[model samples]
Target: MRDFDFHPDEATVRCFAYPASGTVVNDESMWVGQTRQASPYDTMTEDLVLRHFALADEWFKLNATFDLRGILIQPGPPETSFAINCDIATPMVRVGEDVSAVDLFLDVLVRTDGTHRVVDNDEFEQAIGDGLLSTVEARRAEEGLVRLLGWVESGRLASLVHDYALDTVGQAPHPLPVEHWDVENVPSVAPGTRPTWHHG
Candidate 1:
């Protein structure tokens, strides 16, 4: 699980965890990371390249995947390439040396042909009803969703992805070796809390 800081209010920051793996690139305006997924189908051998983008104040996390192996069986067209997660959070901030971001749940699946679908609305609404998310947070999430859709409809997302992909080529190793990750021992940290891991 990837660790993040979830701010419910000005005075509270909760530790939020999500399943993901990648080597992160912290750019001036965004963070780009890439991970590899093995083909789920026994007959396929090629791996899928999943790229993640976290832009400043974008309110959404954009993921573009190159599924060369056709391993992912989703209800979309022949190939779906992008997924956007709308969230209510600030841009990633550095607490000493560790970097993390908050995640509020809502998603959009964009097919290769530019067609797309919004998903996880029920989950977002449920969070609001359960008091897991505030009304203001809900509004921010909705606004983020709208902005994300605009990026899709305007073809700006495609351009952004293409440029970022080019910028990341050979920048880092893909599919970060899990053998080197010690997530179980990684302590949870709140905003202003110093990371316990030593940088040696």
Candidate 2:
């Protein structure tokens, strides 16, 4: 197991273990992680890098990458894309020693053209119906979605990504310690105590 994990729902958690690297920033207010793997597209020979940005108190976890060649095979120039995971709870939490997780519900994909698409409505509703998420959590998720869409609509998402990427460049990623993990039993952050960041 690694220090970083992502929980798509209460029952599901994916850890960024071995071969993946990450680091905490701004007094543990943020976590940046990256994994490099072979390109899944036949048209590309270069490896693909998937980077994750998890900010404390935010309602979403952001995954950004420049590997658009596979999906945009007809591309004229390469473009970066952002995948936002709208979380039902605090976006990031340290569940244990060197271990953190993000609880997610909905997803939004932002393209380079300023166009975006929201997905996973069915899953979100299913989670609610299945009692996986409470009414308040669902409402929080909805609010997060609205804020995220506002970022997209105002072109702020692009700028945020660009600025964060620039700020992280040349910073070497630190390896997470591996240990026996139990994602199913990870602890939750206390309500009303979640840290937040105000974007200027």
Candidate 3:
């Protein structure tokens, strides 16, 4: 443990600001290794973004989940009737637990760490987890590029991914990752606001 020197003003400053980076879309799938590969910061290609949709679909159909909370696995979620899916969420990104095999609702599920738009002590650790998850996402973003780059470089992804981006689209519906919630430098989603600059 570190030592504590809690004078009034110092303690006050510490209380308000947490040990953190600005929040943004943080999914573990974006990160790779110990580094934050691709972030909303890096440039993204249409195909690179599209592949993530494919990966998320494959993983969902196979019931594969990469929970950021670590090694926990999801037992099969309660199956929903094939005829009744109206109760599911709207803009209904990915279908939650409930549906027949052929009845899977495959759509683009955009997970934004929108919750990070504002900070709170309740999910501070979760925020850090989102940042780390960037490594997973960045890799996903450039999985193909990395593969190609790997072929060009030492012939391996284990080699040339010193920097990657972690902004992947998913089909799973779970609690938002840390980075998704914060939007310090991002643009506004206000009325008449069109998506001008595509960062991630």
TM-score of each: 0.65, 0.69, 0.17
lDDT of 3: 0.20
Worst 10 residues of 1 by lDDT: 191-200
lDDT of 2 by residue, 1-200 (tens): 24455444534445566343344243457665655455556666765545567666667777665442322112123343334333334466665434464454688877666677787889889877875555666677788888889988998876665654443433324334434435435444222222221121
lDDT of 1 by residue, 69-115 (tens): 32222322344433443344434555443455545667787765667
Worst 10 residues of 3 by lDDT: 83-92
Show how many residue pairs clash in every candidate, following the order shown. Answer: 0, 0, 36
- Per-residue CA lDDT of model 3 for 46-161, tens digit only, reads 11111111121211211112222221122222231011111000011111221111101221111111011111223323423544223332233234232323332442321212
Clashing pairs in 2: none
TM-score of 2: 0.69
lDDT for predicted candidate 1 compared with the true structure: 0.54
Indicate which candidate wins on TM-score: 2
How high is the CA lDDT of each candidate model? 0.54, 0.54, 0.20
Candidate 2 residue spans exceeding 4 A from truth: 1-12, 18-26, 67-89, 96-99, 165-180, 189-200
Q: What CA RMSD would you report for each candidate?
A: 8.0, 6.3, 20.7
- Residue 189, candidate 1: alpha-carbon lDDT: 27
Instruction: Please identify model 1 stretches exceeding 4 Å from their true place.
Output: 1-24, 41-44, 67-90, 165-200
